[model samples]
Target chain A: MSELELQNKKVAALASTETIDGEIATLNLGPTHPATHGIFQNILQVDGERILSAEQTVGYIHRAFEKLAERRPYNQITPITDRLNYCSSPINNMGWHMTVEKLIGAEMPKRVDYMRVIVMELARIADHLVCNSVIGVDTGALTGFTYMFQEREKIYDIYEEICGARLTTNVGRIGGFDRDFNKEFITKLRAFLKEFPKKFDEFGALLERNRIFMDRTIGAGPITAERALSYSFAGPNLRAAGVDYDVRVMKPYSSYQDFDFTIPVGNDGDTYDRFMVRQQEIRESLKIITQALENMPEGDYHADIPSFYLPPKEEVYSSMEALIYHFKIVMGETPIPAGEVYHSVEGGNGELGYYLVSDGGRTPYRLHFRRPCFIYYQAYPEMITGSLLSDAILTMSSMNVIAGELDA
Target chain B: MSEFANTIKDSLLEKFTKTSYELDGYGEHNFFMSQDEIHPAIEFLKNNGFIYLTDITGSHYPEKEGAEFQVVYHIHNLSENLRIRLKVDLSEKDVHVPSMTDLFAGANWMERETFDFFGIIFEGHPNLTRILNVDDMDYHPMKKEYALEDETRTDKDDTFFGR
Candidate 1:
């Protein structure tokens, strides 16, 4: 319609507000909005440009992962977890394996623990890079995203070197890793460590102090610390709200206590603060990775639990004992202690936990993943209630609500 | 359990007469409380140091006699760096339990997910409906009575799959 028709419609809407309440217009923001970056549907009740209320409808991609985990064996469940937070699959995989190890009372070597720290910190950096760059993209800054995403590809290359898969990496095994860090992985990582800071600084300079970006995100979608904690927020979102409640700092899993780092916090829990918190967290992750590499212990990469970890294909064909171990592992006949354990890791977005219950059976009696995305996405409507439509998109992006993790 | 965890356990036992405590494999404190006492217990803990609600999920057991469904809550005391687990048992016939929505805003979706997957009802939730599944879905998928595998298929054998 022309501008005259638009003016006529506005006049007509205003004239009708004498009977109805303020002429509220319902706008559908997503189910497939381009800015959403995932399948999130929001029904917004808007009066002109200001949002009065918003209702979110998720679960368009529900796959029932917890139900699937009940039938699969302990080792088979790792692949299922790979899809939960696809941005940081290594953390989920490691969290599940650690939960099982906790259940069966398997003590991993120091070398395995250090190696996991390195891999997990790398995943954290990759996860934060995706989140921050997307926040830039949502603010109409596409150049920074394109530049930083190449850095994310380099991180994926390191993942490919370790696990032979890019995204949805089933990287580690039950006891430890499938194998140690190969020479290609070490070389790529050393090169990345040497060169990433310079490229990252360039990317940061583009958006960290840009006046346009600041004006767009400074006060958009703000939440107070009290409200954030009451909503059970975690990770960068919680830290952005001024809560120092990081799982790595609080629980110290996988020898995280050995590494020295700082928990960055922000006073305002807006989109800008969330972005800044993640930015500092990437720096901390680099520090932890450097520490882990410098103090790397010397030992076997995997634990000595033959029943849990599969034997080599060569050994399985050559030796009877190796063949028997392989058969037991493949057939899901390994003895799992009947117990309940909840193990959590500091995932890319938040605390990704695995709550597993075993009844002395091959499969878990019940397995529930404490998906951080699923938990924190509940507060989106509350955060974006009175903000502009564009600010709502920026808030969702900064929250890093991956659809796979949200719907799993 | 650590000294701090034991202190919290002792405080809970002293306050609630019927509550009991056990240690899990990871040495985390596990408290068993009655369904009626859950709200008060959580409120008390919240007033004390356990301010953060980590998770809320449910598990089901068919062969168990009286208590077939267990609703679990993981509450975290972030300042003290201590974690605790609480379990409340509900039978198959009556699965009603109080909602934590009044205390934590995050409980809205977690409780809905629990109700959607296990059919356990959180009675006082403001908008308790199916989440992570279609609105018209009839059955709870996570309950043990529902088999994950296709029972009608004849091509696969259970023995070969080690079921």
Candidate 2:
């Protein structure tokens, strides 16, 4: 056959399997796909470039966090919480601590609450930056990712000064912080607060209104407000769908009610809308941290609950009561009250809730993490149903489904 | 319970007379209902401003006779800024509860996760297979009977560790 005829034959063969209507091909998006950024497996049925349906297989990294939490003493469980949504692990740690405090009815000091607000806001900024920057990376924009990552490093440095750890920071204790912010922490935070805005605004200007970014994300994987709610979407994802339901504003845990920050809501609930919502939320988080720091309360760093908080080393060495309490706590013998409490915090991704059922034991009888990633990720297949495979990847990044959080 | 929770309780009690309401730990609203009343009560709540389904999870209570499993649903009313926890106790003999996927699409995975962990079956779940665990695994890992540490491990014996 002639060369033209051979080309025609090849086109016909391709059309038979790929180009023709209703001809579907299965694509495995990952148990390990680079663009996914996490260990999520989506068995996508594609009609050419358009996705017909997506069946996701999660739990590839399921560590059985709830089961493990049931066995560990309340304090030991903080480390486990660190792994969930590790991008904003401080929020998880604090949320767990607050849940325990609520069960025990330990009233935290105003200073502790303010300190928590600052740390939680910093963690939120870190989480949103990771998510939004990943969205940019998915859309072939690498400069913004690099820039924001440097800023995230500064936040991590602050975390290091506070807790002596960076990522997966087990930052706080049951009633409040393990220790008050040191001079170094405050100085670093102040520096971060001063320098962060200029760099952040530069990053924002790079993609917020850029024609390429907008075109790539504007209507990709859009979901209506009603559908978004039905899917139990939370955080920036839900806000992108035009819902103004922020857990911070709605519930006001950790003295969030005292801060003055606006909740940004978007209209489209698409990749672009999700991106913008997170962008504006970082600004709101900055506002919250500044406010919390400006109005820093004067009091103890942690609550006066001796049974929960570890006594000072000097006291533990000199005082019998301190020695006994410290030994009891270290041995996982702290007397936790029997109660059922569901406490939620505005986590980096969404409303991170802890449903703790204590049976008056040292450890929780049952602990359920109301992981926002796991709940909202169920909507992914629906969101990207008719969109291109590229859009599917973008949508996944925009949803900010951390595999740890999703599988926890 | 707060005033808003009381309002919800009154409305819920008015509709579902078989349900019981109380303030849970931290004074949050909690409703205890039979398996039959869950779907209708939740539907009513959905119609009455509790549209957001926050989470669905199950806790295993092997010691509790006749009610070995408890399924919990946390729903939020965004307009009122109130949250209510609804629970249904399932007997070991019949570990099935009606799925709320019809009401909240988010409940699909939550119910699946519940089933995966506690073996609490959601009767109407479109896909009720194990979500976070291997499909061939014989037992749910979250049940109290399953020890947190693996029994099959031999190297980390308590005697060897001087316990």
Give candidate 2 misplaced runs (Cα > 4 Å).
A1-22, B1-4, B150-163
Instruction: Quote the positional error of residue B39 for candidate 2 in Å.
Output: 1.1
Stretches of candidate 1 off by over 4 Å are A1-21, B160-163
Worst 10 residues of 2 chain B by lDDT: B154-163
Q: CAPRI verdict on model 1? A: medium
Which CAPRI tier for candidate 2?
A: medium
- TM-score for each predicted model, relative to the true structure: 0.95, 0.94
Among residues 3 or more apart in sequence or in different chains, the pairs in candidate 1 whose N, CA or C atoms overlap within 3 Å are none
lDDT of candidates 1 onward, in order: 0.89, 0.88
* Candidate No. with top TM-score: 1
**What's each prediction's clash count?**
0, 0
